[model samples]
Target: MAGKEGKGAVKDSRINPFEDTVQRLRETFRTGRTRPAEFRAAQLRALGRFLQDNKQLLQEALAQDLKKSAFESDLSEIILCQNEVDLALRSLHSWMKDEPVARNLLTQLDSAFIRKEPFGLVLIIAPWNYPLNLTLVPLVGALAAGNCVMLKPSEISQGTEKVLTEVLPQYLDQSCFAVVQGGPKEAQQLLQHKFDYIFFTGSPRVGKIVMTAAAKHLTPVTLELGGKNPCYVDDNCDPQTVANRVAWFRYFNTGQTCVAPDYILCSPMMQEKLVPALQSTITRFYGEDPRSSPDLGRIISEKHFQRLRGLLSSGRVAIGGQSDESDRYIAPTVLVDVAETEPVMQEEIFGPILPIMNVRSLDEAVDFINRREKPLALYAFSRSQQVVNQVLDRTSSGSFGGNEGFMYMTLSSMPFGGVGLSGMGRYHGKFSFDTFSNHRGCLLSCSGLEKLNDIRYPPYSDWNKQLIRWVLGPKSCTLL
Candidate 1:
């Protein structure tokens, strides 16, 4: 299910409960409590400990909320967050160091660099899908950057939300970290207060709402609003190999991932071949009855389950298309003969459903992908190196995968983010630290350089202007 940014209707006109929490954190931030690199490292280490200690509790919470399997939880959520934390810890000191900037002859004797400093009292609004990962991943970045943070985990994922609100804070310093829990109305109310920086993850429709709210406070935001990511299958590839990789990632976490291949773009002949291969792969991966498989997870909520159930009508059910509302389980489904105007085509199918839309050639597939809003991730499956290169060169996306899935997400060196409607800003690894920190350009000149700096003083003359111009000009640093 895609993350929801609820309308946040405040019916009773109740007071915002987050005022004290905000003020308290602001006070702590003002006191310079979170500024030291050592303090930041300690918080990050403690966060790692939180995950290691509560692995079982977290798994159980995920199971309660999404029926997420233990292995999937560890692979997708826990391990990924841990990797981010460890990476930040290992690189913290260097990341905090000021980066030296080249100097002109006018300021050649001055020390100039960009100091990365924290944006105090930030807010991280995480999504329900991959709750622990989404919530803590940014939390790790915020802490590493020395920012006191307030977390708003999706209320829909009550199990993980409970842990974040109750257990996670105990691991870190409460003065510098906090968790506030509520539904749409409460979140909207919380958004009313000003934050130094805001990080949001969810759908674009709600991204606008968050952006609008941030505008009032002039807060910088990193919005990870995911879209309907496309997966293009080349006619040159082996069907089974593509099917195994595609099916595994698409159905992983019951297709609740934002980066999962939302639909397939391929030729009619390829579609015909892929259907059977996908069917075989699905069976091999999850037993015939996917609902009984512990490896598979359930939809997050009744509303999302019904929405996905309705989307199954968009095309011919080429494979599994069963739904059990009682269990919030929708069978891993694939659709064929689907139209572009169908409901499934228009929206991000953040569920266990994949649709194949027929295209005549590679050119047509590229055009089809380009016509839509840029997605957070795009996948191309091909055996030929030229074909993968063509897709990468021609299309625009936040991230790309060739002959594979979202494995790029595992690499700390690579940035994970969206472009255009998918979302804004890059984060993950060093990018995360950079996103949370303010790069302040600084210069320190010697007090004894007053006589040497007199050429730039207000006493203007032809000789002084000529000297200042040449000293500050492009040729000053050039070789004679």
Candidate 2:
């Protein structure tokens, strides 16, 4: 019995690969190595170098995992990370500065400001669909905020995972950052341990699990979950223009994006027009044979391929439906005349499948969209501004695109995130830094103000009470 107990203890000690790693990172963070703006900028610069020096390797890994092209890799993943790093480096000084606040009558002479402090240790869990962008983008923010970050790259994308594990850590400070090396089991084990903050980008179902675990330790979490985003088309719009924009964004990244329009809401007549227009756009975007197109990427895994294949049977295949399981290649597809009760409409279709449903009128389209959870992104197409405004005013989403797609992500000034089930917090530029940092309210009062502090202490008469109330006016702060 003693030998058996000893053997069990040995296995349990080695169960979580991150136990030692997290401990070491926590120790390093306590040393104040990551607190200064200079050190933070240095790490951000090193991260930028990591992206530049290993651009080819990253592209190759992405190709191996998702069959992504060099152009797509550069445009979507590498460039985005680089831009984030550059922005962080340039803005680190100002971001680190203490922000002053308006003072009240009592504290007029005292210094008051909000200081942004690091949360110590952070955990970032990335999704497989965008292995690089999703992982590094959050890391950029965490590091800029002077937090020791542990990056958990998606295990499903093994090629990219290998690079992130073996290559990424070499570029940044080893003491402040780590790349977790394991699968789902290891991830679950790591979650058992507490973290200061957790930033997760994946499906909503998994997001709940992360939040539940974080709840035990009272750790704050940012869940970047995916949802069924809707794109509405009005009768007064150009079919070809809308089709081109929607098709490009939908099919971008093989339709694996979280913000991609999952389905279309339009009238029967508009659906009829969009069907042919979308067909032409798909053919033009990816030659006659999409399977042969280099711009097109394969599904990240066989499990995802099978799941997407199952959704293909939901509605009538209006445009492209051909798929090859052998290569994990799913052709850009369009489903028409889909019912709201269908499986495609029920969940986030994170594949190259776009389903179009018929609505009788604009009010009916709005009603259909409002029936489900709010989407991460909502798009409406119309030549008239009033028609677009109506949809915008009625619906609430994390973000909106008027006759466009997720192009808003390219700008560093614009913050990105979801609402409700789609996601919880915003991150992209300054928002990312703020998400990881704790804004500490601070006030450094004058050291010689002892006499003023004693306002009728232990002898609070009616006159003193009235004076206190009068001093704290409507516009003044109640903090006094």
Candidate 3:
């Protein structure tokens, strides 16, 4: 009875948690306490401890939201968040170091350096796919960059949201980091307010909305959106190795991963070999009936269950098409003979369903992928360097991987994000810290050079003009 009343009250009030977050952050920034590097380090360590102590809670939250197994949750979400914390903790001093730049010909008389300064406040809207890591990791970056952050965890994953709200405050300074929980309406309300930077990871449709909303404030945004991530099965790759990797990705969190291989693009002969291997691999991993298998995960909710059900109406099912509502499980489904017009082909199928499409040549697959929206990730499985280069040269995606699936996300050195339609900006490790910071270029000029600067004064002369040309123009080859 109270739940119904609470729903009505929420609808009537339409109160936005972000408003509170921004208000608190503004007050915190005014204190000038966060300017110290020591403060940032302390907070980061606290965050690290929080993740370590509450590993089980995090795991259970993911299970409640996505039916993710303990092992998969650790690999994909919890451990990654912890890794980001460790990375920031270890390298923060280097990131904050004042980087000097060698002066160009014109600026030789001046000293120039890039100072990485924190943006005052940042907002991160995380997706449900990897809810724990996506939200926490961005907040980690914001903290390391010495910016106040307001994290809006996806409400769809209520279990994760609950843990975050309960646990984050204990470890983090409430003013510097605020974890807000709500649905799309709450996110929409939050987007209305301006922030120095906004990091979002979700669907493309919502990415556009986030962009459009950010436009009102002229805020810079980092959008990490999904695409029809392609996984090419070339003949050269070790069939067993490729199959094992592919199967692992396809079934990880029941294929509810942003970087999960959405479609497999391969030759007819390769498909014949790949299909059987994939089938055997799936069986080996999850056993004969995924519906009853403890290793397999269930759909996040009824809405998604319906979405997957609709895709079946249009596409021809090749393997494993089973569902049990009581268990909230969908078997590892593989579809062949799927038309480009089908719904599965149209959108990012964020489920355990995998689609295999036969192509006449590599060029055909590349053209087909290019014709659609750019993906957040495109994976090409090939042993041949030439085939890898062909995929890289012909297609456009947010990020690419060779002979692997979803591994690009693991690299802290490399930036993680998407391109057009897939996403706008990049984040991860140092890249993320920089994303939350603004590199302010500072130039120092010598007072002794004031006489030399006077040569370009308002009193014009032929000699002055020639000197100006020589100074302003591109340098010549001869040494003085």
- Give the winner by TM-score: 1 or 2: 2
Residue runs of model 2 more than 4 Å from their true location after superposition: 1-13, 477-480
Tell me the tens digit of each residue's lDDT in model 1 across 293-369: 98999999999999999999998999999998898889999999999999999999999999999999889999999
lDDT of 2 by residue, 1-480 (tens): 001222211123565655767888899999999999889989999999989999999999999998899999999999999999999998988998999998878888899999999999999999888899999999999999999988888889988988887777777887778777567787788789899999999989999999999999999999999899999999999999999999999999999999998999998899889999999999999999999999999998899889999999997998888888999989999998787888888888998999998888889989888988988999999998998999999998999999899999898788899999998998988999999999999999889978987764658888888877777876667554
Backbone clash tally (model 3): 0
TM-score of each: 0.95, 0.96, 0.93
Order the numbered candidates by lDDT, best leading.
Answer: 1, 2, 3
Give lDDT: candidate 2, residue 188: 86
Question: What digit string (tens of lDDT, one per residue) describes model 3 on residues 314-372?
Answer: 56677788887777678888888877888888888988888888888888888888888
Better of 1 and 3 by TM-score: 1
Compared with the true structure, all predictions reach lDDT values of: 0.90, 0.88, 0.81
| Model 1, total clashes | 0
